[model samples]
Target: MRKIACSLLLAGTLVFGMANSDVEASTHTVKNGESLWNISKSSKVSITNLKKWNNLTSDSLYPNQILQTSAKKTNSASNGISAKKGTFKTKSNVNVRSAAGTTNKVVAKVKKGTTLTVSQQKKLGNDVWFHVKVNKTSGWILSSLLTSANKSTSKSSTASQNVVDQAMKLRFIPYLFGGTTKNGFDCSGFVQYAFKQSGKKISRTTLSQFAQSKKVTSPKPGDLVFFKNTYRKGISHVGIYIGNNKFVHAGGKQSQVTSLSNSYWKSKFDSFKRL
Candidate 1:
């Protein structure tokens, strides 16, 4: 009788556990200005699991899109990092960059003692950099400057968004002739930096850039809009097309967002191209 009672108790506990697991599986309706990267980090679910659950083939996500935020079991924590978990804290004042390399644009500076939510880590040379979030900002910080707490989980921004985000971050930087760094930019230099933030390498000059790309008649967001005879003749200026007939570039004095439909730009419009 004792043995039978014990067996019945175990079976009941298993049934309860199964029910509880089902309750944990929940849905998330994506909100505006949110991406799979943002949602995955906040929900502690891996981007891989989020895609798997919702049957997403790409990192593209739309506002009001319904997604599976939870499940009975998921690879949410399997972010390929060997660390026991993803939670971490800054060891010092660390400059977080857009990508894993030091050459990438600095996105944020996390002061010492700040807590960070890690999304993933990548080995760059002999050092590892943790892709982390602090407050609402996300970027990569050297792992040596972080102490993992082994308590959390990770997601990354999509390529197109990354390009736009990087460009937007430098909206007010001064234009420097033949410059390519975040400190300053020329027209083509600005374009190069923006794409590099998304892990895409592009030509360094406006003319070479024009030569490399295939022309597109109907320009889309993320395409390159070229201008002829801005300062010189033929493909001297380029800007990123960001929809709504507006584009961003490092023009005469500084990096600024302008309208493609504006009289000055409209007159010089050569063609739109995609790299």
Candidate 2:
């Protein structure tokens, strides 16, 4: 009974995080005198709807914050180090919020991964974005500003929304070596656990799994790919492709998002396959 209760709790939390977390669009710059409520009225999208979409809970905006609309803005690019876990990507939005739980509404597109640190973590009605410390300057940012890269894991096949939805719930779980199920996962363990959620049971090792699945020309939403150097001499670690050129795998400590085009990854690149 205790084990069953724990399983239910974990499943419930994972579902909640995925449902409430909608990566907000990158648009409208926050002017010195502006508020989200006003923007909502102007845009014709209801405040309630906007909050629901962006995972917000208030009615304010900040200066110089770029807001994403339906409009197609040219992609912006920059570079930084890994401030926290996860590969903070090339065109993801970095959200900014205040300590008072008011909407500070500062948003920016991440050019590269920055070692830029975030301190405060506030939860108003259970929305969990971070309070980031801007790089090389004195300013604040909301955890909502960041977005996971939309890269594909493997092109063999596209996963249903349910599968992707299930996989995303484990975004922050720590990587555990030899972990192949729900208790925890290393890169390959994460792959098995996610596939299991979708009613599939995959192999436990990268080398073994790599030999299995059918190779695909391109990566799609839910596919498996392996990496070298991380585990064995040749094909070592594996990850689930999330689209674009990225996959979400449990790196050393946690399961954050990552890419295949980066230096280390590019060099260790292996074949991608659909299961």
Relative to the true structure, how large is the alpha-carbon lDDT of every model? 0.79, 0.61
What is the per-residue lDDT of model 1 for residues 1-275, given as tens digits with 9 covering 90 to 100? 99999999999999999887665546677899999999988888899988766545468666666677876433435323433236787878889875567886676788887888776676767888777778866667888888755432222224555677788888989999998998999999999999988789998999899998989998767788999987888778999988788999999699999997789999999999987
Question: Where does candidate 2 have its weakest 10-residue lDDT segment?
Answer: 74-83
Poorly placed runs, candidate 2 (over 4 Å): 1-161
Deviation (Å) of 215 in candidate 2: 1.3
TM-scores, one per candidate: 0.43, 0.41
lDDT per residue for candidate 2 within 1-275, as digits (tens), equals 99999999999998887654433433555688888777777777666765543334345455775554432232211111122433223234443333324465334434445545553344446455444544433234444555433333222234444456667888888677777666677777787778778777777777778888889986667777777775568788778777888877888688877878878888887778877
In candidate 1, list every pair of residues with a backbone clash: 119-154
User: What are the C-alpha RMSDs, in order, of all predicted structures?
Assistant: 17.8, 25.0
Model 1 residue runs over 4 Å out of place are: 1-157
Per-residue error (Å), model 1, residue 48: 45
Q: Which predicted model would earn the best lDDT?
A: 1
Please report how far candidate 1 places residue 165 from its true position, in Å. Answer: 1.5
